[model samples]
Target: MNELIRLVYASKAAFRAVPVTQGVEPSVARILMQSRRNNSQVNIGGVLYFGDGYFFQALEGDRKVVNQAYQRIAADPRHREVTILSLKTVPDRLFADWSMKYVPVEQAVRAFVRDRGYLRFEPLQFQEEEAEALIKLFHQQRSGEAPDIEKKSGWFGLRALLPRKFGGSAGR
Candidate 1:
């Protein structure tokens, strides 16, 4: 039986910033292309968000396939400090219409981040509530609604605020 599941992960981009050509970074564009091809082939669906040298992605598919895909991603050298934020069985796919939807952070979301006390888009410092909010924001964006970034007063890399036993590092 095909056990559907959802796996969310975050990682830091290992490569230096390259100027975005045509509104998409060359490296990120390449990743998106590859993801679309591979994911479509395997019947996987998901969304990917990139900003400020970090990646936040949610992949949904069969249990085995999703695990295999996560393993493959963990092995990828392009990502560092790969972390699995959430992994759970689900009754249906949230992004069934997309093979691999790539959602860019909108200005509103950037502002939202600022409002949330995060000066930049660093996924490493995201708390569980923050992660869930981001996921919901991405879903809203996918649904054609504009997502807003919360503006708070704080900087990034404040690991002390993180959960003691939150998501575990996956790829290391």
Candidate 2:
């Protein structure tokens, strides 16, 4: 049986400038469009969050494919200090429907985090459970669903919801 892997990473954006208009930065939009096309071809699924010169991404798919994609991303000069927070085998994919879901630092989400005592969308400071919850929050928001932040068990509880297959340690 083929094993699936989920890899999460945090990085500092090489470019910190924001667009003058109300939309995604042109460069980021281009990247997202290209990534969506490429990832779909390879069966990759993931979510990307960008805010305050930082980037937090969670990628899930076949082990080898995900690793290769990570390598390409690491080589991209747009990202600095790229660090993998977690890379472990899982029984299922979390962002299965999205090839590359992009979440920018919007006022609503910023307010949500601030209300929760978070200064920013910094996934590096989050535990595994918190990170999962954040991803679920973005997913819910994108789907136009009213997210219940108090219900932290939404996606974080997947570990308990499904059986584990491969026993592998998370990467640094």
Candidate 3:
């Protein structure tokens, strides 16, 4: 088996930001749903943060699997200027329970950005220390089950907004 590894990357959104409803943008929701499905199948776990037209994601899993996944992400049309921030072997997964945990850019992160002299969330400008701090914050967050779209009737509304290629269903 390949050694467990963690890979962090940042990317700028290629698509326009959709209005956020139910605390997440439509495009992001689609991405999160797909991630949950794909990662779970490959025994990968990760945390994703989306804000201010940028994405900072940390994926942990077998080294080969994680690298394959990163290659797919780098070629995704929805992302531009994708750049790896960190990649290294690790003893274990930090987000073991989450196939793909979505971490909203909450207050603590906002303060962290301001403290670093950034007016908005911009992971591309982050140095190694800032990136590591963000990962630490991700570790501190409690892991929750990925939202059950079928059970949460409220999410059904989001299905309509998804592209037809994705089957317009959460995690389909």
Candidate 4:
């Protein structure tokens, strides 16, 4: 059987706000478009959540390919303080159908944060488990699955902005 791996990570946006681009499209939108194409070519799949100057991404694919892709992400100037939250070999991908799913900062997520006493979705303030939970929550919401936000066990703490994980080093 082919080996599959899941890599989860987060990072802070280098810019304080989404920067305007030369074209009609916003920079973030261009990034999403480019990423979707690139990820598809490499057979990578994942979900990306951007909010409050932060990013939480989960990449799943062949171990080596995922690692290579992550290297490029870490080196990208748009991302700062990239940190890995989890790197595990899962039986299957949680986001296999998506090349790069971008989760918008919608009302449901805002409500979830406010109800939890968080002023915003500042991932840097979240602990490892909380980061993972947030990623799962967004993924569920994007996939039209009902997330059990009432499960209090999964949310807590904030440390750094970006969470990233892969089998190899960033420079590789």
**Index of the highest-lDDT prediction:** 3
Looking at candidate 4, the ten consecutive residues that score lowest on lDDT are 150-159
Query: Cα RMSD for candidate 4?
Result: 15.5
- List the pairs of residues colliding in candidate 2: none
Judging by TM-score, tell me the better candidate of 1 and 3.
3
lDDT of each: 0.77, 0.74, 0.83, 0.71
**Candidate 3 C-alpha lDDT tens digits along 82-171:** 988888788988877678888775687899899989998889888877887899898787544433334345545666667667667544
Candidate 4 positional error at 154, Å? 38
Worst 10 residues of 2 by lDDT: 144-153
Candidate 4 lDDT by residue in tens digits, 1-172 = 6679888888898866644333222656677777878987888888877766777788999999999999999999988999888888878877766787776645767887787688877665666666667767866765432122311223221112224353322332
Best-fitting candidate, scored by TM-score: 3
Sequence-dependent TM-score of model 2: 0.73
TM-score of each: 0.76, 0.73, 0.80, 0.70
**lDDT by residue for model 2 (1-172), tens:** 6779998888888876575456677767777888888998898978887777777888999999999999999889998888888778888887776788777547766876787788776655666666666666776656332122312335434434454553222231
**Tens digit per residue, CA lDDT, model 1, 44-119:** 9788888878889999999999899889988999989998877778888877767777786667569768989987
Clashes per prediction? 14, 0, 0, 14
Superior candidate under lDDT, 1 versus 4: 1
What's the CA error at residue 137 for candidate 3, in Å? 0.3
Clashing pairs in 3: none
Poorly placed runs, candidate 2 (over 4 Å): 143-172
